[model samples]
Target: MIEHKDYCVPADTWAARVAGGDRRALARVISFLENDDPCGVAALKELYARTGRAHIVGITGPPGAGKSSLADKLIRELRGRGKTVGVVAVDPTSPFSGGAILGDRVRMQGWTGDSGVYIRSMGTRGSLGGLARAAYGTIQLLDAAGFDYVLVETVGVGQSEVDIVRVADTVVVVAVPGLGDDIQVSKAGITEIGDVFAVNKADLPGAERVATELEMMLDLGNHAAWRPPVVLTVAASGKGIPELVQAVGDHFAALVRADQLVKRRLAREKEALLLRLAERVRREILQSWSQEELARLWSDLAARRLDPYTLEERLYSVWKGAKEA
Candidate 1:
């Protein structure tokens, strides 16, 4: 078995190669990182200084919302504008194989030979949010690789998928016509996360109704920055793609004008820093405490010799000490 210590060194080496535009090296680094090897985290930290160059757009929606098709069309449109695009498709993990299905690749296969396009599929990997830690690290890798645009297509929405807003510069929430009831159920979270709303499959019967409902919701909400625009698109037929792209551009421009992009960047940095700190503290605490110590603490709690509040205080002190050391 490969030890974590052995893996960390090569992961940083691979990360350097990836930053130098070595595609095979990038792939290997990403794959290793996906497996949650400790080396992968080390590699990601090494590459962190090179990131934050790319414009990240997150595409999220309920299952069967044609999000993949919409993402494909968006990539094509972006490429047509002479931009290099990186796509990160987040898919559900296979319980049996411990790998992702990568179904989005089937829809985005046209870009296989395009040197300007780098496409990767990520597994949820038990991440509470639609994005895994590896996926976040991969996006940074692509951003550092100098991709002009990065598109993140998430593994549809659940309660946790709302976290996409924290990572994406522009978030496009796609929904189909027949899912109005479902939309209503999830509107609070989705509405707040989306910078732009897309009514995909516009050729369907209830597209207008969906659009109207979204518009009304936006109007009702007190969004001082910009009201999220609801655009209709027939993603399969490639209809309304141009308008959708335009809407995205307009939203990006609005963010820039309002100086929200700077705020967003700062917020993203803060989030990344906090996550890193939390992970480090958690790992150090786990490593420093022996099994006997853990058992003793638990036994004390069970016997009422230690109260929950006091135990929490003691744990905090231990964590602080570990962090300081």
Candidate 2:
């Protein structure tokens, strides 16, 4: 396991600044993490003890589900209750700039000047799971920063979006009306992941039908402990947002009452640990291999003299030997 002392001492100041509500420091740390800097990891380690205070909420669904609109409304609702919010909007990577497309940032301009609200737009960076690769760590940073709520708005990609469940304390799967065939196609993939379902654009023609289908889907599953509530929301009009917020709060309360909160967080930590270990091993292996060795391995593979499976075995053996040493 990596320790705080492994890194230089400067990160201690970054961690303190982040915890003390320095948004600039938090932004810099997020950038460092996005760029894969070791300082970000060190600061995170230093601030790890201060995390878990914020409620991490994931807003995700297929494209055209109005997720960003709903997130904006939710932020407003939470902030009205005097709760500070941190929003991490996962936008599609711009091919030109290699940065966020900035669509969510544009929509969420209302909160830009509010000191209690900090919104960050993160490019998906070709990450397939609707979230940026650095989103989980960024959520922890926001938690450590003392935000009452950390809302993660995903890129609204299809089914593979289940990654949100691993990080969020509450997952709100947003569905909009008028996408009949698309909804049918996504049912098997996304219907099972929601703790709360939001049928946004409630004023649309098929809003009730979408809500009904969601209820039917929920009924098909065994949710004896807590059933996910379907809330009809017109995010643009702020209709039913309070109810949506209540549903999210109810789900969280249910988790706490059932003693599942800590268990879920523990599972998240385990996953993060495993991922970190794998990443470190991969980096170390790559660094240990000389350019000539790498080139020769690639040449051999291309020439059909070495198979990928054998190459994988060889790398594993090297890693095992290094571990023993």
Candidate 3:
């Protein structure tokens, strides 16, 4: 049903197809992106202008916190309200093949027949902070494809995995009962990033205790603009999911009412630009260093002739010189 002959290059054709709501084309481009292929990067560039529409919600928590189930419920809730959804579920990498070890695609298979929903599983690929390197690009592609919402389900590394804050319009920190150190986890930097705290598995005992702890901790911070509400949810049965969805909507509405949406987006854009620049510099430094040069530097370090700081300076100088050249 889709024509591909209009664009000359494969990237152009794929980009055009994606812009036209072709799911297959979008998946193909995302695959190319995950592999760091030039075509994928080119396609993203071509489709960049059409992005920045979808609301990106990030769900993250500790292992066994039911983040996936919460995401599933959120998708159903959103769809019930006539909104289209896209999901990027980040999982740990397979040591041998460097692919996603957890098959989120299989877990989210219920949506396979729904044209309005698209889900993709991504491996962290050794990137830290609970996300794949291609996550931002994948979100952009989904946004360009006209999805109403993009849910980024981070790897359940821990409460410290606040990287989702960098990409999500609303960062929902999922917590469950029986995590003995729930209060400590909240104090450990998650409270600062969370726009909504979801107490999933609310059916479990001590759920009220966990919510109270979160509320008490939030009271200490006294966030003026918007206070992150703690919503109780039993994601497995979809109980309290509607309230969680409403909490997310309220946060977005508050951001818009306060005229902070554009400000947050601007900050996100700046951070993304800086990250790309850093990656480019790192790539250039690695490419500029010859094997012998690297070996000599390692040899110098091993022989105690040079410190890591000095080697880093030398490498920076080389990168700078190459850029100038």
Candidate 4:
């Protein structure tokens, strides 16, 4: 029961309820984060100090690679070990509605009654990096809510999907067999971010070959400190899930032992800070501005009457005016 004024939870009360593991409170805070509520920001500022406890595992790979199924199995496996889990499932947004059509909740409905697991689905919402604008904040809220693990599942994979590596403690890239040239998971840029590579759908043909190829790629790469392991997983049947979980733990342990965990955490903080600052600056720059003005600017640029750089300078001048006003 969050004490609220106009649907906004009080900061102290919000923190108290979340700390107590109240599900409703947690959901309300999550909504606040999703909606970009000021109250949510305040609660986050208070709860921020309590974060960084949960291990964030990011599951990302190409479409149809069973990333969601793997995430579901991983949750079960984690719960078997007496761990509570939180999942941030990123789904592609509907272009017209700007809402997630098949968010993780629809697929993971079985866990709806489970007390040890919490699942949240976010629409990509036009965000380019396969994450919602509020994702970083959501993870911290989950951490402050006392989840043992926070798993982030990206919408899909590509070189740009590497943003997951910036936030997750361990990144597991899931791949399937039979895609020789169309292997999106193993692209040179995408391969470098994976802490562990999984050849999923092992029941299918060519799984072994995919695993072998991943291992060979790892061998060729200059991963001086640690070589990412390629594991076989049939996510649908739960095959190799235990081993995959172990691999995730092993990678985390390696990071810890090498004193690299703090370095990654530092990088995550830097990224979050920059992201927030940039968004804030942009929002303030456009506050109360009309769409017509922007459209006119675009039209002028399209007509080549105004160069982009000159328009940007003019926009900055408008921002300065707004700031002073």
Number of the predicted model whose TM-score against the real structure is largest:
3
lDDT of 1 by residue, 1-325 (tens): 2355764565567677878777887777677667766666677777878887788898988776888899889888888999988888776543211233565343777777888898887755555332456777788889877898888887555444335676789999888888656554255567777889989989989898888877877777898878888999999988989988888888888989998987997898788668767866666676678989989999999999999999887888987886687
Task: Give the runs in model 4 whose Cα sits over 4 Å from its true position.
Answer: 1-9, 94-106, 124-131, 159-162
- Give lDDT per model, in order: 0.77, 0.80, 0.81, 0.79
Give the residue spans of candidate 3 off by over 4 A.
Answer: 1-10, 93-101, 104-106, 125-131, 157-162
> CA lDDT of 34 in candidate 2?
75
TM-score of each candidate?
Answer: 0.84, 0.87, 0.89, 0.88
lDDT of 3 by residue, 227-298 (tens): 999999998899999999999999999999989998998898788778777867787788897899888889
Error of 1 at 153 (Å): 1.0
Q: Which model, 2 or 3, shows the larger TM-score?
A: 3
Clashes of each: 1, 0, 0, 0
Q: Write the per-residue lDDT of candidate 4 for residues 18-121, one digit (tens) a residue.
A: 87889898888777766656667777778888998999999988766888899999999999999999998765543222234655233565887898999887
lDDT of 1 at 253: 87
RMSD for all candidates, in order, please: 3.8, 3.3, 4.2, 3.6
Better of 2 and 4 by lDDT: 2
Q: What residue pairs clash in candidate 1, if any at all? A: 8-39
Q: Can you list the residue pairs that collide in candidate 2? A: none
Q: Lowest-lDDT window of 10 residues in candidate 2?
A: 91-100
